[model samples]
Target: MNVLFNTDKLTRLIANLQTFTGIRTNTFDAAGKDIQLSGGHSDFCRLINASPEGHARCEACDARAVEKCLTARNAYSYRCHAGACETVLPVFESGTPIAYLVFGQLLDDSSVKQQWENAEKELGWYQGDLAELKEAFLRLRRFSPREMAAYAEILEALAQYIQQEGIIRSAEYSDLQKLEMYLDRHYMENLSLKRISADLHMGTTKLCTLSKKLSGGRTLTWLIAQRRVNAAKSLLLKSDEPVSSVAESVGFSDYNYFTKIFKSVTGITPSAYRKTNRS
Candidate 1:
């Protein structure tokens, strides 16, 4: 398959997968760890972020794979992540799996009859109930085999593009991270685009452009506000600090503004946040 490795095309491919297959694509750097996973109908992104599934399984499975790969050496596929029922496909470049594309377990025309038969065959050997499995199978959405092949081709192109374009190792995000880390450390201080730009030896306008790109289109001020709000979450969890105190600690001088922004981002007031955590 022809692969375009530029950023614009990569973003478009990711968007298309989300639109068509209802599956999300996650890319890793040269390392096996995930950089980001998005655009999936399943909340597997959230699960992978907080749960010990993919990487943990990969570590153990990597060693055991040599024995299993006796039948297939050219390409390797295995699914043991909590049996979440989604298939994970590894995208390789020069024989190394650099990115993983996840699809399947969706509800489609053939899944019902096929899964029921398979479940019955393995029912005595497997731990999960066949009825529950059937129910879960029926609930999910499925893509046709043609759709699967199309998505696979797009992902293969994306993987090739990532390897050739150096997108994974780009220094473009470093300055943004530096500014974010600086703000994280010194948010309580007087912070503005001017002061931060001066410190980083960048112009305010350029900084603004980078800020939007790096923060997923959130302006610099919004990013700071989000940081403050996130900090308030931690304080709510770990400290008995009053709402106003937590607000001040995170750089919001005005308690009302803090409450407004915190609620806007988290859908709960700071007081409610603390109370829920406490309860």
Candidate 2:
């Protein structure tokens, strides 16, 4: 399920908070999928990212925490799978929970050496350089329990904001968020109206109507293509992979067609864009 909050506004808030609190934060839907800042994942998360087994374990950890918050009917904090403290604040709608404002991955007050040893054990068998992981652990934001409570209050306020704004901008934007969530999950695939509408369980026409309204008149296809182009741009700028491979990675199968769309959307060829960005 999508978070019932303004992601852009929340992102801006998270960014600003980092400047003051030096703590990273993220919001997740009730299902544990990140919807906002989710701040640069902790160093230990980087290790888990490398191994599918460990990633699954971490997901299960998140699932359990989400379950506890949903069942307990209150916001709470728990230690992450990687030995860092984290909190989950459920955002409710009309007396039902819809999303969670998650803040955490901070180190507890203790000996740094012991913390690393415990983190290595908690992270289990994974493949990133342990030294790097240690560095990341050392760099994590640390706070006392009192400070954490104060930070969580910020997320609570934002959650309340989402609940209020949602009343004024309900169904239309909800449909928009649903579409965005779908695109975020399936952006790597060859997507189309029939498939997207099917997933949302709505007719293509209504889907298009909502997409148009949500995007201020841009068609559903526009958003899909834009998402792909944006991904392609990231790959182009960040990786040394070839243009054709980058195009394919972002859901474009035909290299020439990918170039056409890339140029059309970005006003430059992929190679040129890459070179310019590199320079």
Name the best candidate (by TM-score): 2
Off by over 4 Å in 2: 1-5, 167-279
The C-alpha lDDT values of all candidates are 0.60, 0.78
How many pairs of residues collide in each model? 5, 1
Worst 10 residues of 2 by lDDT: 165-174
lDDT tens digits, residue span 142-207, model 1: 665566566566655665666666443334445666777887787767689889988989889888
RMSD per model, one decimal: 18.1, 17.2
The candidate that achieves the highest lDDT relative to the unseen native structure: 2
Instruction: Give the distance in Å from residue 173's predicted Cα in candidate 1 to where it truly belongs.
Output: 2.8
Error of 2 at 14 (Å): 2.1
